[model samples]
Target: MEGRKLFAGARLRNLRQAENLTQRQFAERLGISTSYVNQLENNQRPLSAGVILALVDGFGVDIARFAADDGDRIVNDLHEALSDPIFAERRPSRQDLKIAITNTPDFAHAFLTLQRAYQAAKDRMASLDDALQHEQIDALPLPYEEVRDFFNYANNYIDWLDRGAEALATEIGLEGGNHLKLGTERLRGTHGMSVVFERGTMDPDIYRIHDPGAGRLLVNADAPRATQSFQIWQQIALAEEHDAIERILDEARFRSREARSIARIGLANYFAGAAMLPYGRFLSAARGLRHDIELLAERFGASLEQVAHRLSTLQRPGARGVPFFFLRVDRAGTITKRHSATRLQFARFGGACPLWGVHQAFERPGEIVRQLAETPDGERYISIARTITKRGTGFRAPIRRYAIALGCPVAHAPETVYSDGLAIDRAEDYDLIGSSCRICERRRCPQRSVPPIHGQISVDARVRRVVPFEIS
Candidate 1:
């Protein structure tokens, strides 16, 4: 930072545009001349320390994040898109990509959007028989992807909902009380919704059924107490904080009604998680416990997945947590849920990397597996993975299986209990991993499923190696 000049003109300009401020207005707010702002926005001059501090003070920007490489994901996505066979003959150079992103990031985003649509179309084409049989050929983005991207861009923290849930937690005296009892009491008192546990009478697939007409909430008596408490809190969210959730939905402006509805449930779930583990108390406990997930889960009466997901959402403005990334992957390697407050970005189009410890968690269930991993960009992280098994009520009932991973950058590893005896300074101990096989730039990896799409390769019939071809 002392000698390295950061030309973040595109980011600065995008920030100004988002705030709807003109160059003169932005300059005045920063106590700088319009010409200087112009030069900075145009990349004619690098951002000075004074300018950076001024921007931070005036706009409440996170100085640490402001200088971060926010466009790294965009650049990576662009590389993946350009690797398509259609662009094989005219792919832009890596330096050209950096310049384009620095000068015109919006165009890069638009190109990525188009490329995603094209890829979706190609995938649909591959299933032409099913598409024709079901008459379901459509190029619109998947609702799940749209919602996932929305949460990703929002940094997985919805301020209004979080505050509302925190307030509700305090109001209901959940700090030291049993969450299930308190939540049920609040539902009955505030919404006139009495809880009734239906043992064998409840439908197997339905965890909870809200009966507005009867003023009753029928919950599966056999479900885990934590899950029942979660359902109760979810109802509280819809009943108590409906307006806040709706306001966020209105602002999100999802492309389809299905996406909006899915997002609606997602927001409710978020509220449930936040309310169950209120922010201030949770953050204090996390720091005091050095972020011991097992201990935190036991204290909060939350499942491992819930605790991990809640930990990732502790991104309040002045009271940030360890900046962990939470991810869930199914047995077949599909990423079902992902959110990263750290620099590592999950692959956009596929499963977690085959080499990632999250995938290995499936092989060893019920145990925490820790790994020191380095991405292709040289950033190292300390991740812990474990399998989450959802048991069915009956022996014949279907069981659900998944694995979850939570991690943070190596710089913050000292603050986590999981990093107790790990060799943090040993570079050779870190396992080199990547976002996805198709976009990974690593030249050699025994676990690679496919060659990097953006690199040249040499294949020889007489050659035998870990992989069929050598990447150049």
Candidate 2:
């Protein structure tokens, strides 16, 4: 196989098929003639990386997966792949590279887009690695709760999944009963297809694919059976009943199309997690365990992070449990993940302020840190964060790791074990905390690093404000 164009044609073809648009139809979507689409797909012509950008930007495929031998690595791989021998003679000049990346409409999709995340993490890690005097620092403080907040918006999907698995463990143990394999067969019998696990993937995340003509369904096989089962159920739900998911995406005051797309994907992921961890039973078990995340993990065969995450998602229309916000952030204040189903407005831009407790979850691996934060305005909430490791459980696995966090308003304290002897401050009678230093107006905030939004103008050397910021 010619190396330089490795998977480019295949990716474009896959995108066309996935969109259910004929080559002609998809070409129309890209505003390119079918001939151009043909040339690209058949390898008669190569798609500059810009075109690849258009595929993701114009359509909704996760870009991380699109340009991969598998979806696991990052942007650097895409850059390296293009430098392969296939393009030896037509070598993309530095000028070509610059224009394609910056000027090409295809690549501009990401340019105008705003996810500084992966880059931010890389920068922060590099900084920390130097400061720690190690190539890869063993640990940097993480904002696990901020990651929780990412999921909180969708009702704590992590916990929904964890709790769901736990309940299944209780009702029917997680020990391999050949049930997972057998279950897939049963669904295949009903749906007239079976799961497909493609090794050396371009996209590592689990997914389901259907072949209409052959009446076959393909599912990524890397996940645990529980995860596979959950994926199957999720695909079914969205395919059959996507009204609610569509509604949320359509309805939210999303700031950008990218955010909306991310939200839709997030919402679908949430729904699937919910179906797997049906809210009622999981919620009851959580309370039953007195919020012991470890016990919940064992019972459900889920990661500790998973159980803690679901605890925050106990929100349903009538059965509304707790109003919680979850977050996952690193020491540099970059929020890697978050969810919010409550009025808990998360900071949309900027890294979260360093003063929050979620950032500390990294320092205490496998240990839970509980904090009571009272906003400058007098609102209080309880936050809990912990480190959860993610890596290959078997030989020679890739290392993907991070921490997670959870927080809910004080009103919901009685329902959680975190309430045990937790100190609540007055004036500060609540856990004095704010979502972001940039937006928060808390003038006397001790936790404040940079003063709140208007704090800079308010400070006078003579009339220095108590919070280290000035107020007129």
Candidate 3:
């Protein structure tokens, strides 16, 4: 069999642009004709072995990665996006999608971005309509959603903030030490902020309160040790890494001030987690422990949620860990927190598929529920979910509960402790799950709350199945 031809026009053009060279200049450096370079950049010709060698030798491009198309994800996202009811009349075939992505990847990406923006706007409008029945209000982008997209597009890893937090952690000896005490000392000595633990009757919902004017920080004594430590580190982030966080926000270009403000809190929280876990040490420990959440939490003095979230952010350039997606959902199936470093994206608007193990986690609280899940796109993942409860200070106070899930591609399953004794190779063992009901194409899902938006359903009087109608 002959080797597959590599038409990496986008990659080739990007590589040339990165070197600040024109097509002619790039061709000259590669010892190729300008016409040939043009043809290659325009996808009119495939990259030859000689050209690949020249790229490796001259531009230091990894041929394996440079020649790779990364279009599978784009295709999957396009399929989901086109599955919207708006495109019900005309859906492209899988082959058509592959050709589109391969030929015009940038356009494909822009389309996906537009689809996301449209979905976000639709959700926001619906929310505003629900809240204001008679009043005329302008529907604007939701701050939380904007911030979520920011982190999601960034692959849940803010490199500058992560590195800065890691350096600060190292400077302050946060690893293998009393993190809370160290963080408190750092706050007091560096920022001249007084730390006060309120043992008295504080608000049940309040965990940490900071008074910049008074230069004092108040913490609830009844809160967990992990919460206390995290809050302290968050303060340190605001105090020390304010410039770095501001730089990130400036580049992010949030639509509204509310989004920017929310992102500030999110970046602070990210810094706290990064500082507490400190990328290198956490990654090493996680690998050593086979990515065990409980053991890693214990080792880092972090909570399960923190550890799981940190695991998703381990997407450093060279030294990367297993790409995992972390998610948190409330009892009502609302996604409170989500970040995916993998291709398995969560539904942006509607909640995840009810069949997901994360939803089942609520049934068996405290017990880790493991699942081998396959998405509609045929990607398999090993998901582990457990319910977490945040208790109020008193018995009469309210308690907040949520289920958090962390998972990666099944290829990385062996690196996780949750995969023990599992049927990794059994195709029948994998549960079929979809991104959402609106985008899911599965016709036989018994738990489907609604029909797929893009398809026509026939409701015959005499026909009854697991679903109410047949999808066409």
| Candidate 1 residue-wise lDDT, 1-472, digit = tens | 4356889888799799999999999999989999999999999999988998888788887554456444555666687789876787899987899889889976886787677788888877786756677675566667888888777766788777888788878876885349889888998888999999889777667789999999999998878888889998898888988887888788777778999999989999999999989999999999999998899999889888899999998887667888899999999999999998887888888788888899889889999999999999899999999999876588876788999999999999999998989999999999999999988889999988888776789999898998999998
What value does the lDDT take at residue 412 in candidate 2? Answer: 78
Score each candidate by Cα lDDT: 0.85, 0.56, 0.86
Best-performing candidate as measured by TM-score: 1
Kindly provide the TM-score of model 3 when superposed on the true structure, using C-alpha atoms: 0.83
Q: Please give the distance, in angstroms, between residue 139's alpha carbon in candidate 1 and its true position after superposition.
A: 2.1
Q: Estimate TM-scores for all models.
A: 0.85, 0.54, 0.83
Distance from true location, Cα of 298 in model 3, Å: 1.1
Worst 10 residues of 1 by lDDT: 63-72
How much is the lDDT of residue 289 in candidate 2?
Answer: 74
| Candidate 1 wrong stretches, greater than 4 Å | 1-73, 89-108, 129-136
Q: Decide which is better by lDDT, 1 or 2.
A: 1
Cα lDDT tens digits, model 3, 1-472, are 0267889988788788889999999999999999999999888999898998899899877554355445655676688788887786788998999888887877986787677778766766777867666664435456787788777767788777888899988987887458889988998998899999987577867889999999999998888899998998888899888898898899778879999999999999999999899999999999999999999898888899999999998888667899999999999999999988888887767898999999999999999999999998789999999999998666687889999999999999999989999998999999999989887878788888888888788899897887888878
For candidate 2, lDDT tens digit of each residue in 300-375? 5555555655666665433556766666765566777666555555665567656667777778776888888775
What's the residue-level lDDT of 349 in candidate 1? 87
